[model samples]
Target: MKKIFFTLLFFGCCFLISAQTEPKVGDELIIEAQDGPTYHHIKFPKLNILVKRGKVANYKSVHGNVVIIDDVITDKDNNTYVVLKKKDGSKFFGYLTKVKANYEKSIASGEMVVKS
Candidate 1:
């Protein structure tokens, strides 16, 4: 009886830990581009040229990547942003568009999600 109780307790703790650690919206993630070493590029509002996300900006680690939530836009454009911050404090933004075939591949592969 004691052994069974301890086993249950151990499993319960493990479950709680895993659940708590699961990624959520606004959580940053490190991802690699499928095409090559280059990061994903996006044309953001008020930006003239396309900005890239990932190693190009020197945010190679997970700590540098920032998950973006589109809570501000209530429309159904199905677009989300991912922000990357460089060591020099520069920030670049990219969008996850379902309309784009390349982005669709990344979304399907679980490389990027709305809320993980």
Candidate 2:
């Protein structure tokens, strides 16, 4: 009886630790830039400077790896936005308008891999 109880307790502790370590969609992650100067410039048309890999930028277009915190949000004018948080503690407001499409694309491309 004592051995059985101890075994179950050990397993329970392991389970809890594993669960806490799992990555979720909203979790911040480090994403390496996969594009060149032209790609960054064209993608982030508003930004004038070339974005370097591993450097966090304000615009989502500068990154292929990003985290969409939640679902699509609509404003009074029907403008949509997606919440994106970077690994460097920087948050993008109104990051992307086409939330559903972008989210699907990210998942399909394996850019956003939430570890189980």
State the local distance difference test value for candidate 2.
Answer: 0.44
**Candidate 2 C-alpha error for residue 107, in Å:** 1.2
What would the per-residue lDDT of candidate 2 be over residues 1-116, giving only the tens digit for each residue?
Answer: 99999999999999997686433456543333433332221123233332333334444443544444544545696543344554434433334232232333444444444433
User: Which regions of candidate 2 fall more than 4 Å away from where they truly are?
Assistant: 1-71, 74-81, 91-101
Q: Which candidate is the best by TM-score?
A: 1
Provide the overall lDDT of each model, using Cα atoms, as 2-decimal numbers: 0.40, 0.44
- lDDT score for candidate 1 against the true structure: 0.40
The TM-score between candidate 2 and the true structure equals: 0.31
| Per-candidate total of colliding backbone pairs | 0, 0
The best candidate in terms of lDDT? 2
